[model samples]
Target: MSTFTENAPGVAEQSPEAAAGFTLNHSMLRVKDPERSLHFYTHVFGMRLLRKLDFPEMQFTLYFLTRLLPEDSVPEDPDERTVWTFSQRGLLELTHNWGTEDDPDFAYHNGNDAPQGFGHICFSVPNLESATTWFEDMGVEFVKRPGTGKMPNIAFVKDPDGYWIEIVQPDLTAGLGR
Candidate 1:
């Protein structure tokens, strides 16, 4: 393994002063079919649709979804829900460009192909075995299965748009023998 030298060049600074009020809000991905994408995310991954905004002028729509814990309370009012959704973390934003679903060849690069870029989004399930079994029963495609890969405790599933979603159990990963 290579260690960082004293004068090692950096792409970004490691200064907290430059990021005072910063927090990771969400990550966005473009989907070809909004309906299929929404169904896959909601039913398969168990994410709730927090908010959706349609822009007729731009010919696009934005769908924001998040995993709401059992103890979390969602506000009833639209204004309150909007504020609460934005203030929370681990949100997933899906962008649908209007008319793309009509084009049979329309597909977004999943960023894990030849020229790899963005890899995947992950979810930490309470039980790895049960979660993977549930995913298998739902007919979800798997890129990597737990106990088959170098990291036995982690698995990867593909969404409708072919984007990878890594699944792991927090307790199991601690004993990976790293």
Candidate 2:
């Protein structure tokens, strides 16, 4: 019963200081199977499927996901391509462009864990140990364990498609200037 609105607030209304800070709103990924990726994200991370759009002409299916929370609500923005929003801390956008020319060679891996020109999406977790164990129990392969010396207690894990996800702790002391 969710609806899309064209009267959503602009960037200025959201955060005026971030207007010029080049903030990252969402990260898009091209997946071979939309349903498969959807299952991985929803089942493993407990993310809710906010909305899904089908473009018959373009042969594409866009899926939007967000962390579930009591205050989570969708925003309206007809001027932007953003399909959905969540009250969660961050946004996860899954793009499945179907019927296009074959993209069989698309791989999320870029050699090293952190490759130049490669972007890895990060998410904050309440407890690093619990999140790590949850993913491990779900058969997700981890790239590394939590490293303490770093700014944030971070651990890297790979998705079913081999995409990297940086799991970080929400402790403020773990970040810079602590």
Question: In the order shown, what is each candidate's alpha-carbon RMSD?
Answer: 4.6, 8.8
lDDT of 1 by residue, 54-172 (tens): 89999999999998889999999888988887888879999999999999998899999979999999999999999999999999999999989689889999999899999989988
Candidate 1 least-lDDT 10 residues = 1-10
Best by the lDDT measure? 1
What are the lDDT figures for the candidates, one per model?
A: 0.89, 0.69
Model 2, which residues run further than 4 Å from truth?
1-24, 74-89, 99-115, 147-152, 172-178
Which pairs clash inside model 2?
Answer: none
lDDT of 2 at 15: 38
User: Candidate 2: deviation at residue 42, Å?
Assistant: 0.5
Backbone clash tally for model 1? 0
Give the local distance difference test score of model 1: 0.89
Per-residue C-alpha lDDT of model 2 across residues 71-104, encoded as one tens digit per residue: 7455555323243353233567787878432566
